[model samples]
Target: MRITENLIFSTVLQLLEERPVSKITVTDIVRRCQINRNTFYYHFAGMEDLVQHLLQAKTKEFLGLKRRFRRPVTFLFYMMLVASKYKTVVLNLYHSDMRGALEATIESICHHYTHLYMASLQKMNLSDTDRELLIRYWKTIASGIFLDWLKHDMEYDMPHAIKRICFLMAGNKDLSSFDQLKN
Candidate 1:
């Protein structure tokens, strides 16, 4: 059952790379997977359900990673790198009705890592509200960067751009002296 589900999931992702989500139907998915509609429906309620499941599965996969980073910026970089691997799929979802699901996944990832980073700071004391606000702020910034990249068709050097943004956020006055974090 899991194997069939995975096959369906991968087929959808492959289809997404070729066309936008709006253009994809369950028939297309089942046809590509060589599965019947009953099998597809047994695993997914509809296209939206499949998309939500896909996003949730992706978020769980990312959260399951054992490698923990001391800095949230590093986590953000890693997340972006992973997303860049499926550029067309991401862009397709971003421009489709499923954009909210994609954004929620990004926010979930950002919040998880940001909270972990905050918890690692043993010397700092923050009120719950303040901590929430800080996480939200960083989440917004990270989401903005990602959406902006998609908006511009992802032509720029993401790593260098992220490093520069991190340096600026760190309050480094000399742009020429800014050094990328050795992660």
Candidate 2:
């Protein structure tokens, strides 16, 4: 991200903590960053464009976190950690008309991580349809839980909650197992 873009991004996120995205204008962002409207326009086409860029940028950061952990569950834990870290901005997006941006980001993260998980299961033989269904299933489950946490003001122990849910899912014999995971 360019310096000006980063400045505008941070400004928008900070402003989001105080107001909804729909209510925030490019002028407000430039004014907060102490820059002119033209600068904001130069960096972003408009407020919606800025919001989408921010979402994709942040999603990349979370996906990058997957490289540090070998286990899919650990990668997921990091995802929750980030959500908790940015609770204020997340809640702001949730209540705003741009909620889909947040949801799309979550789905993208889950989808990428699920592909990694499936790749790790070398002996698992799932059809293309099943694989797609599986990815969507995990994506929905993960995103649903994360959104639930956001909706409830993030009062729960997210890491522990995710761990328990994983344990429960893994413990179900009929749900298919990852026991064939490559060492």
Candidate 3:
């Protein structure tokens, strides 16, 4: 059963690379997978369900990264690298009606990594409200950067951009200034 589901997932991704999500249909997926319509329906309700499941599975795979990154920016860079591997599929999805699913996946990944980064900085001693705000802030920045890359058709070197961001962030001597603002 899981194998069939994976086959369907792969088929959709391959199809996505060739064309936009709106242009693909259940008939196309099942035909490409060499599976019957009943088999496809058994695993997924429809195209939207399949796309959601595929994105969720990708998010799980991303969250399973065991290597500890030194900083949140490094983790974000790794996430971009992973996404870049599916450049065509991502671009196709971004330009398609199913863009919401792609954006949701990006947001989920950013939120998880931002929260993880915040938890690792135990010495910061941030209040719960402050911590939540910081998480939201960083997540938005990460998500926006990624979406902007997609918007530009991904022509730029992402690693170089990330390194510049890291350098800029590291140069900020008053990192704890935010704490002073609340006083």
| Best candidate (score: lDDT) | 3
Better of 2 and 3 by lDDT: 3
Under the 3 Å rule for N, CA and C atoms, how many clashes does model 2 have? 0
lDDT of each: 0.82, 0.75, 0.84
Better of 2 and 3 by TM-score: 3
Best by TM-score: 3
My TM-score estimates for the predictions, one after another, are: 0.86, 0.81, 0.88
Please estimate how well model 2 matches the true structure, expressed as its whole-model Cα lDDT.
0.75
Better of 1 and 3 by TM-score: 3
- Candidate 3 lDDT over 1-183, as tens digits, reads 999999999999999989988899999998999999999999889988999999998788778875565566777788888888999999998998779999989999889988888887778799999899988988998899999899888889877997776655556666545333211
Position 48, candidate 2: lDDT: 81
Candidate 1 regions off by >4 Å? 169-183
Range of the 10 consecutive residues with the lowest summed lDDT in candidate 3: 174-183
Model 1 agreement with the true structure over 127-169: per-residue lDDT tens digits = 8887777678767776778778877777788789987776574
Error of 2 at 29 (Å): 1.4
What's the C-alpha lDDT at position 148 in model 3?
89
